[model samples]
Target: MELIQVSHNEMAALFTRPSHIYNSVGFALLNAPKADSVEFLTFRDTRLRGGLILGMCGAMARSPFSAPFGGLLLTREQTAGAVEDMYLLAAQFAAGRGMALRVTLPPPFIGPGLYAKSVNVLQRLSGGCATVEINYHVDLRGVTDPVELYSRSAREKLRQARSHDCRFERLETTPEAIARVYDVIHRNRLHRGFPHNMALEQIVATSAVVPMDLFMLTVDGTPAAAAQVHRLNHEMAQVVYWGDLPEAQYARPMNLLPLEIYKYYLAHTPVRILDIGHSTDGGIINRGLCDYKESVGCRATPKPTFTVNLRREI
Candidate 1:
């Protein structure tokens, strides 16, 4: 096995089918503007097997908070030996550059067993000091019928929202539309006292590389709530950014928007999972946030972050 440094285009070409949006080269490109430096690393045997896209903050530290989730994107046929070799090479590279390696592995969207090899490799490398974040996702596979899948409370809220003559619109990905979506998201984050995850420029740039759809819920022809959804792959879709006016909460547009989004995908798309992302901040879980997601028929999954002290390992 050999580890090589490749361009972003090369990495994207090699890992043609990424399981999660966060693991894709497109996501790394979106984050590139904010990063001091970005590097795309590939691990190969006789052929390209796995790769990772990483960003750095100066020479001493790697930027961990840039991407929501990023680590190894590997094929199932790759052996455990290949996994170890890639990880060790990564560790050595980080050590040589005087940087600590930090990466978060997203939950497996393919099969439950797909992440087993990576988890084992991470555990050994991180000295069993992995931190787990609780993530929520709606399983859309068995949801042949929306009535049975959604909770009673959620269903009732959706009905109430519809009775108010709420309309859900799937907007085109135009610059004006993206700007409007970003405005709502920006205000929502400020209201909640949460830091902005990505700038509008970053979001716009990334959306161009990876196709995303913007959905909005309007009441009486007025925009109430919206979300930027990423079609991660054939099997999964994710709600990356969601926002609603404070006044819209009174009308229950939040509940209505996601329900409608799920319904549309359930009927029209082959996607099976709707990832709502983590309800945690800085390793602390928010019960109210988690409860709201549960009320809408979402369940928790474990997403773990792994860190290695390259200085010590070297």
Candidate 2:
């Protein structure tokens, strides 16, 4: 097996159709401003097997805090043996550069076996550590009625939102609209005592490379809640950022925004999963956040991160 570094466009072509939006080339590029540099690594045998987009500062580190997920992307046939080979090569590459290697794999929304293979390989590597966090996703496939997927309480909130004349609109991707969406997200994060992971400028850069849409829920012609969704592939899409005004809590536009977004995808697109993303800080699970997601018919899945000291002799 051989590991090679490729150009941005080459890496973009390989990862653009990934099962997770966070692993896509567009996401990596858009968020590149946060890293000192970004590298596209590919693993091969007799044929193309897997690839990953890595961000580096003093050394390459894969933190969900910086990027939602970053690890090996492999074909179905590439299992334990291939995973082992890839990591070994990755270690060698990192060692050559005198950098430690860390990677976090997204939840097993794509394939269970692949996730297991990756974990097993990481465990075998010297000084390896594996940690996990919970992520939630709403399954939208095979549901004839979108309302049927929500909990009783969520359904009632949707009804209440509609009663208040809450309307959902897909905002045009213009500079003005992007700025408006960013303001809502910024204020929401501040109110929640968290920082924005990607700045407004970074989000705009990402929009240039990825297919993203902004949706807003309005009441009396005023915006109450908004979200930005990124298309991962034919089967998956993710809500990268979502928030509501503090005053809009009474209107419950947050409930209506996702409900309408899910319905829109269900009726018009082939998207099977709507990723709500992980509701955790570091490795700790936030119970209240998880419960709210579950109430909206979202199920929990484990998203794991693995780190290894490449300096250790193996």
Residue-pair clashes per prediction, in order, are 0, 0
Off by over 4 Å in 1: 59-65
What is the TM-score (0 to 1) of candidate 1?
Answer: 0.90
- For each candidate, give its TM-score against the true structure: 0.90, 0.90
In candidate 1, the residue pairs with backbone N, CA or C atoms under 3 Å apart (3 or more residues apart, or in different chains) clash, namely none
How many backbone clashes are present in model 1? 0
Q: Can you write out model 2's per-residue Cα lDDT over 1-314, one digit (the tens) per residue?
A: 89989998988776556656667776777678778788788998788888867777676555332666766765445768888888878876776777767878766876677778877788777445767778889998787777787889888987888889777888888778888898988888889887888778777877787678888887888778889887766788888899898988888887778778888888778888888899887878788888778887888888877776776564
lDDT for every model? Answer: 0.78, 0.78
Query: What does the lDDT come to for candidate 1?
Result: 0.78
Predicted candidate 2: what Cα RMSD to the true structure?
Answer: 2.4
Clashing pairs in 2: none
RMSD of each: 2.3, 2.4
